[model samples]
Target chain A: MIPYSKEVLQHFNKPHNYGKMKNPDGVGEVGNIVCGDLMRLYIKVAKDKKGQEIIKDIKFETYGCLAAIASSSMLTDLVKGKTISEALDFDRKEIVEKLGGLPPVKIHCSVLAGDALIEAIHDYFNKNNKLIPEKLKLRHQQLQKEKQAIEERYKKDKAV
Target chain B: MKKVYLDYAATTPLDSEIKKAMLPYMDKEFGNASSLHSFGRMAKEAIEKARQQVAVFLNCRPDEIIFCGSATEADNLAILGAVKIAQKKGLKPHIITTAIEHSAVLEPFGQLEKEGVEVSYLSVGPEGIVRVGDIEKVLKPNTVLVSVMYANNEIGTIQPIAEIGTLLKKQSQKIIFHTDAVQAANYLGCDVQKLQVDLLTLSGHKIYGPKGAGVLFIRKGIAIEPMIYGGHQENGYRSGTENVAGVVGLGEAVGQIQKTKNEIQNIKRLRDELISNILQNISKTSLNGSREQRLPNNANISFAGAEGESILMALDQEGIAVSTGSACASGSLEPSHVLMALGLSPEKAHGSVRFTLGKYTTEQEIAYVLKVLPKVIERLRGISPVK
Candidate 1:
């Protein structure tokens, strides 16, 4: 069994803002079913006092190990009140540090959380017909490639 | 909190009676069986007695049972050795095995395939059973052997070994039939003649015996090449000094099973209750293998949206020990191949859990597990994103 930190277990047992939001402004779903880790992130955006678009609320649902669930829960807590640009700058490393660091095998869970946030931001931009930045587009393409690789590997393994 | 162990299919706790039977061999009676001394005779006699004990359980000749390091070695010897013997007769050896075989059998067949052997892997149906007709369709004049497991380790689905055995007997061509009966030895009667098997494999630790002991039953008049080339122990079939203490424990364990056969019904009743409760109380949960054809002590179920590893960890925290069909526990990210071969979706396969009862499993332990399992499943399902 993975030696999960007490904080990670706490978040996993009582995750905040779990479940789906009705008609959310932005949604991001990532990870593969074959890899046994999938996360769907939802965000409701609103204008703050300065007329800057900020994440008014966030929720996540994860199908994976303890670390994956905990990472998703922590990611929602970190980005709830932050501006869209500020949330985009939120690093997965900070999530890991806050969770007292995940096992090496489970570091991918933190990365998944980071990727879900980026995809949700992209969804927000796409909803408003705003141009997606080149860097975010590149990262999305890379995540797509990783997903294809995992699917191909799963197919080959099942064939064997 | 009291601990409840339900992972008997993985391995069982060594019975105290078996330990007692092994103690003398590990201490005072430490003479090599091959030596020409009085001590050697005593040691040799004890080895023969254990062999006879196993033979009585298997209903085979004492000389036919060859003790090896493990069931893995026995499986390797049966496949590689039989194929080598067929190769010596100027025939291209063809082998057939089921997809659900343990890695011990599959790896040897894989090595043989690399060495230019014709090998065919038969697929099992959703019931986790290989149709005898499928085996018949693949058999050829040069097919040297057919190896299938008697029971699956993950799902505990018992195969129709006797039916397959009977079909092979009707074939005009001589095709040696082998079954890895390691999982069936404890609860099932393994009469070689009645099963019509040419070779069979049994493991010690799986039957509440000591580890490092295994048996490969080779019928008389069958010629096979030896994989190990050293001292001509066990009539040159398996080479090395025997594991005396382990063999004694294996014999005692088999003897105990034979003596206590009546207790199996009690275990079956507990297993039935556990399965019915989990399926009835939990939503979106289903059993994996054939209900009627499965072992009496086995219950393999899958929760729709929960991940198996997380459920396992939660149960571990609650002092209930069980095993998951997910390969992640063994440091692999893939789900169970057995569950996959049974046509389960990857999500369902990844969420499977196996609970195998034992001779000592009681009603109270079953009730405790039933009480705790639903809460764990609900907890994991709440966190799952698959819905």
Candidate 2:
């Protein structure tokens, strides 16, 4: 049996922000049924009276286990009142800790939720004509490079 | 919320009486059954008594029963053993089996096929029942064995073993009929003579017994070469230190179920009602396997447009334990091939859930499941993109 924390189980049993947003400013969809998990995050980024682009609302739909649902639910709470930049800076460890930590096998769901949030913010900027932020782009590229290195190492090990 | 365990097809909880029956073997009387001392005599007597109990359940002579580590090992011994005997007699080995056999049987056959042995895979129709005529059609000049399962573990479809056994009896003297009866032994009476099966396999764990013990029933005079080479044990057919506690547990478990078959029937009645209510109350849900031609306590349902894992997780939250299919392959991303063989699309196959009832399953648990399940299915389907 999977020992999900009470907080995770609670959100899994009763998820918050669990539907598609209407005419959202940004939308991110990741994973699929074939992948054993999927998440769609929608955010409405509005210009606050101070002219800062802040997330006015957030919602998510995830098809996975308790950790996936809870991670997505917790994503909503973290991003709802934050500026687009703050939401983009949100880390998965904070989400996992808030839920009192998920099982190791289910940690992938948290990473997926975190990636979806950043993707949504990127979508927000792409729609607005602002240049893609250089630091986030470099960070994404760095992750790709590390992933490639890991794949190369795996291939070499397999060959050996 | 109350917890309901409905994955008996995967395994059953160890019966307490069986545990009690096995206590002495695990502790004080742990002497080797093969020794010549007084302790050995006591252990050997217990082994013989357990063998008698298994034979009583199988309705066969005790001499025909051979203990093995598991049904998989038994199946390998039966199939490969038959092939090896035929090969020694200068015969080309040919075997027939169904498409939906457990990997324990299929994987061994698959390896044999790679070694140039011919294997004819008889396909089942959408109802998941293998036609006896297909077996007859595939029977050949060199056919040495016909291996089919007595019951399917995934969708709970019981095969027409009596008919198959009768057909195999008339096919050829050389063609031995073997059926993996692991899932059927708990609910179905496995009288070897009545079924006309030359060999049968039973797993202890499937019938509330220990995990590491099983029986392979080879009718007297059927030639089977031993797979493992070692000192004589199991009459030279299998070799290993005997799993005495496990065998004892199996014998006691079988005896307990045999005496309580009537009470089990009552549980089956509640099982049938639970399936009926789920089908009646839930829309877009259909039974996966044969309704009438299945284990009395098995229910496999496919809820269209809802992922099986999600429904299973939801049910888990409510403490209603169920399964997507064989626990062996649940972690894989692939849908159950057994469901796909029964003519379900991959989507429908992925949406399938199996609920297998056991002796301990209760009507109140079913009521709790019925109360919680439809809501979970509806909520998941509401979020599903397919609908």
- Give interface RMSD, every candidate, in order: 1.5, 3.7
Residue range B84-194, candidate 2, lDDT tens digits = 999999988889998889999999899999999999998789889999999889888889999999999988898999998888777546689999999988788899999
- Itemize residue pairs with steric clashes in candidate 1: A62-B385, A63-B385
TM-score of chain A of each: 0.94, 0.83
Model 1: how far is B161 from its true place, Å?
Answer: 1.0
Candidate 1 per-residue lDDT, tens place, B1-387, comes to 889999999889999888988999998999888888988887888889889998998899999999999999999999999999998998998899988889999999999899889999999889998899999899998988999999998898999899999999999988899999998887787999999999999999999998999999999998889999998999899989888888888888777777657878998999999999999999999999899888889999999999887888888888898999764565567778788889898899889999999988989999999999999988778767776
lDDT at position B4, candidate 1: 94
Interface RMSD of 1: 1.5
Most accurate candidate by DockQ: 1
- Runs in model 1 deviating more than 4 A are A1-8, A46-56, A77-83, A93-104, A148-160
Query: What lDDT tens digits, residue by residue, belong to model 1 across residues A1-160?
Result: 6688998988887888899888899998899888788999999999999999999999998998878889999999988999988988888899999999888888888999999998888898889898888888888788889889999987887677
